[model samples]
Target: MIQRISHFFTAIVHRILPDPLIFAILLTVVTFVLAFGLTPTQPAELVVLWGAGFWNLLAFSMQMALILVTGHALASSPLVKRMLVALASSARTPGQAVMLVAFVGAVACAINWGFGLVLGAMLSREVARRVKGTDYRLLVACAYMGFLTWHGGLSGSVPLVAATRGNPMEKTIGLIPVSHTIFTGYNAFITFALIVLLPILARLMMPRPEDVVSVDPRLLEEPPTVERTLSPDATFAERLEESRALAILVALVCAAYLIIRTIEKGFVLDIDTVNLMFLAAGMILHKTPMGYARAIGTAAKGASGIMIQFPFYAGIQALMDHSGLAGVITRWFVDVANVHTFPLLAFLSSAVINFAVPSGGGHWVVQGPFVMPAAKALGADLGKSAMAIAYGEAWTNMAQPFWALPALAIAGLGVRDIMGYCVTALLFSGLVFVAGMYLF
Candidate 1:
């Protein structure tokens, strides 16, 4: 009866707090109250500034949410799944699937971290469906392999740009320049080796199922579905093209604003500018200006909720910074640890810290203040340190509970399954750490 009551309450919370947006609101309200106590400055004074800054921050949050939603829509389609299956079918064994997925994920992440979540999940599911072994645990493990490598590749915007915000390494290492630090020979070698080594390790670590259980015929029964005769008059392509107009318009406006902002400000423009642009584009493309307005209203109905909660997360960052907790921790890492080994310590520090703070931006924001200074002081190569931090952040995602949420949902797998696969990845990534130490 007690367990039943507990389960009922859990279900109720899941229903009521159905999304992160809801969590964001509650977090913000609590943060607003807590912020009053954290800062040395008075509440009224902080409020005046926070009031001015809050809108822009909220706009950024909304933009992040939109991009994530839009990306999910694009990647979750039937066509992409078909492509992934065709590719995975070539692999003969479960371990091969792990390597293939990890390589693809690393390449994609090398290109863009945001895409990593979608690409990894979609690819893993596709491979799982095709492969003989569809144990939820084994498949979940395969999916996260890609998640591990994605950080070191070209696609990761976080690592490529984090140091640009205020990295001293950018200044000191003026002689050895490249568009991406991780694109270097050393980082590339480590990334490639891990991609290759992880599968072999997985093969050893994971034993094949005792006996393959044939799936039940009834469980796999075909659904009664309609078959469409060829429509000579109508084409899906034509319909897709017609619908493409709105999507294209929306994409162009967002891209234009992003480009303009990147050129002027050196990174993507502030989040509000991008969100407002999308909102405006949505309005204009609709039947009428009023239609556009209504669309914006509907799309942004959740913005208020997000605004309320994100500030608290922000407050968490602020408290850590103001209380000197993050610094003290960083200081300890610097003082006691012998970092003369360069990439090794860099990788280790990155892996450990990433477990606690899963965000590249947040990790950079906190660790950057102290790490860059310590690296210079130790006579360690700055670029290597920066890349190490980036690599570590990405590498550790293999184990981060925060990032595992999406993979868990997509694979219908539990935490235990995800962790099981990552154990091998952890061993493979250790090679990356050692390689980074010696080369850099």
Candidate 2:
């Protein structure tokens, strides 16, 4: 039954869903029409909102681009490739490969979402290479499914932001500690449940032998690196570009900076830090300046979607923010919610909002002010309320293709190829989230 359901969704999504870029474009049009209809803002003003917010995510887009390129380069380095291959070798069967990728991706996401996004996809490709007859699309989907645990984990943007001092809602809610939010008994139970159940879910969703779509073996084969030959009389600049010494020196400098930052800040893991670390690792492992450059060139090809599509989503978020549409949606849920039902309602509302504002931090910014005040007035647990919003933002990501771009780019698949499995994940995990909201 589960397999049938999975197949059903996969087929439906494959047939109906367009390319992710087209999906984003359609979403932009839909949000524009909705904002125009729902808000008091005039159509002219709405156009301004979209235009004004279009470039709002420039810095964030650059960071995302860097993460994708750097993480890919790091993964493609000889040392990391060998390590991933060794790990993939342990999965003797297709089912084991699915479970292994799912488990590793979940754990990685728990530690750092950016890292997990790239690691899971890269590892899935490697696993497909090592384990014949593995369903490649399903493998990538399972990898993306691991992202569901990110909000309950250490780098969870919503909880981490709420815990920080001077946050916008700090006056109303005060600084809720991580213990009450991320590390609480209820959260622990939810996280552990997902870590266990998701793998089993992936295993159950595995396609039959004849139906499985394995990766093309040629795609797994690494392209041979072309070295520019230099005579003994090579120019000084040519020598410098090809020098192992230059790459090692830069790597050492980055390493020292990372060590110093860790000592000073006690293990801060932001996107910038992750990008730098990956850059350092890629340089060190690639063994020469030219080799690292070549790897980066290879990786940059995968980041085009990220570079192009993020601004549209940023504009969508801006439209929601400026046009008062997001607030209206939140307040409607609050108006209908009782103390007992607020968390679940907030969770569901957040799931809707996440399709527009996919960033966890961005979601909290818009929803926290309204949701936190409502929680306080109703005497609900603020911690759980915050987490409910967090979970919702993470939950709907199964259907939201924005966050999946990096993973899909790395895996050489389209949104339609994997979203069917992800839709199934969305439904199954939604039940778990509802249970967590009510039971604990």
Candidate 3:
């Protein structure tokens, strides 16, 4: 029955979903019409909001692009490839491969979301290469499914923000500790539950042997040779470009800086930090600057979707924020919620808002002001309320294509290829989140 349901959604999504770029554009159009039709905003005002907000994510876009390119380059490094190949070899069967990728992805995500995103996709592709008859699409989807645990983990934006001193809600909530949020018994239970269940879910969703859509064997082959021959009389610049020592020197510099920063700040795992580590690792593992550059050139092709689509989503976010549409939506949920029910309602509200504003930090800024104050007024647990928003934003990401962009790009699969399985993940994980809200 689960397999049937998975396939059903897969068929529907594959049939209806357009290219991710087109989807982003359509979303922009819908947000524009809704802002004009449902809100008091005029067309001109909406256009202004869209234009102003379009470039707002320029820095963020660069960070995201780096994450994908650097992560992919790191994975393609010969050392990393050998590691993944050895890991993939342990999975003796297709079902085992699914479980292994899911487990690794979940654990990595629990440590840090950006690390999990790239690592999981990279590992899934490797597993597909080794595991004959594996459902490559399902394998990639399972890897992405592991991301569901991120919000409940250490790098969770909501918990980290709430734990920070002098945040806008700090006075009301009195600086909720990570102990109260991320390390709580309820969150621990949810995290472990998904870690265990998702792999099992992936195994169950695997199609019959004959029905499995395995990866094309050729696609799993090693990247084409980019090694350039160097004569003894090679130019000084050519020697520098291909110098292993030069790459190692740069890698060492990055490593030293990262170590110093970690010592000073204590294990900060933001996107920038993740990118720095991956970049350094790729440079060192590739053993030459030119080799790393070649890998990056190959990886850059995958990032085109993100490059084109993010600004549109940024525009939608701006329109929602500036047009007061987000406030209206949040207030509607708050108006209908009370002390006992506010957390659940906030969770649902965040889920809805996540469709437009996919960034966890961004969602917090928009929803935190309203949700926090209402939680206090209604006598709800502020930490849990904040977490509700966190879980909601993370929970609905299965359906939202925004966060999946990096993983999808790495997997070389379209959104339609994996979202069907993700939708199933969304349903099962949603129950866990709702249970955590009430039982915890």
Q: In terms of TM-score, which candidate is stronger, 1 or 3?
A: 3
Give the lDDT of residue 298 in candidate 3.
89
Better of 1 and 2 by lDDT: 2
List model 3 lDDT by residue over 171-227, tens digit each. Answer: 765788888889888899889989999999998888878878888676577777556
Model 3 error, position 418 (Å): 0.8
Arrange candidates by TM-score, descending: 2, 3, 1
lDDT agreement with native, every candidate: 0.54, 0.90, 0.89
**Model 1: which ten-residue window has the lowest total lDDT?**
219-228
- Mark the regions of model 1 whose C-alpha exceeds 4 Å error after superposition: 1-68, 76-78, 155-159, 162-180, 211-316, 337-339
Residue range 340-414, candidate 1, lDDT tens digits: 765566566667666444566666666766776677777777667676777777777665444555555444444
lDDT of model 3, residue 291: 84
What is candidate 2's lDDT per residue for 300-363, written digit by digit as tens?
8888898889999989999988898898888888889999999999998899999889999998
Candidate 2 overall Cα lDDT vs. reference?
0.90
Q: How high is the lDDT of residue 253 in model 2?
A: 97
RMSD of each: 9.3, 1.3, 1.5
Query: What TM-score does each of the candidates earn?
Result: 0.65, 0.97, 0.97
